[model samples]
Target: MESLGIQHFGAFVLACIALALTPGLDTFYILARSGREGRTVGMAAVLGINAGCIVHTLAAVLGISAILMTSALAFAALKYLGAAYLVWVGLRMLLARQSARQPTVTRGRGLSAAFRQGMLTNVLNPKVALFFLAFLPQFVSMQAPHPQWGLAVLGVSFIGVGMLWSMVLAMLGGQVHRLLDARPHLGQWMDRACGTVLLGFGIRLAMQRQQ
Candidate 1:
């Protein structure tokens, strides 16, 4: 069967991959967890993130995302909320004491906790929802009988691209952890770096317009 997706399918996939590869808040968060904790934790985080993305996709299907895009006030409200959440997460990371050694996952609070945090982190950032609202529709063809179906295809594809990239980063981070196992301070550096990146993203998001 023919693909049910964006026009210029090759270009769209390439763009999605490029966006995924560009190291941003998501990448940093994945790296921080996987590098410090292990691949398992990173996988959990990835799953959680995708879970959150799924929710956004559902919201888009429900027309909630469209409302934000169309209404300036709604857009602003969500944008600020997302910005605040990102900044808050960043601040928490910065304030936490740095550990010289690789962090260990708490036995009881392992994958589930990481997963929940990742889900919340993604869901709270209205930017993700907005991003889907703006980005997916562009690839869809106006001539298509069901533009909403096209949107779904593109949104799911975007999530798939992101997941693939995150998986690679997670493994790479785990490798780095093993390499730097002897140097405890490296873990501390990772925390600081992640915190800094998150803060920067928050600031940037706050400044963005709905366009």
Candidate 2:
């Protein structure tokens, strides 16, 4: 029904697609996990990201993001927390030592660990919450009589579309997995590299200010 979300349908879809395609922390996380792990873990990670986005959508709908965005102190506080979380995750990865039976351990603890990490990574980003706060309202139709519903629709649409692209990225990790499967030692180095990338993202996020 048009009441659902027909206003600016073309524009909304375009905007959602553009944002989904844009490379960001989410993309990097999925790719990193997939390349390090495999499709199963990657898919779990994708689900975790979506689960985190669900919280963002709810926060935006409930106006929590509004509070964070409008208050400088609040924004900075959340930003730092997110940055710290990223750095901690990165450190954990880097400092983790692989034992001789690392492959067995990895196989033993697969999708669940990846899923939790993915969810935590997205939820702690705070920037994702801010992004939803800023981006979703643009496509919400005033004529919808219930702008909140319109916002919800836009948020869900973004999530669905975004997840589609994320899955593609996760699949691409399959290539990396195959490449490094033969070189077990390289996998350790690869995790360290991904850990470094996460640290970089944390530093970048820490330096961001409301614009």
Most accurate candidate by TM-score: 2
RMSD of each: 3.0, 2.2
**TM-score, model 1 to reference:** 0.82
Model 2 vs. true fold: TM: 0.90
lDDT of 1 by residue, 91-140 (tens): 76666774465343221366887688788778866678888877776677
**Candidate 2 Cα outliers beyond 4 Å, as residue runs:** 1-6, 99-108
List the candidate 1 regions with Cα displacement exceeding 4 Å: 1-6, 98-109
lDDT of each: 0.76, 0.82
Task: Write down the lDDT that model 2 would get.
Answer: 0.82
lDDT for 108 (candidate 1):
32
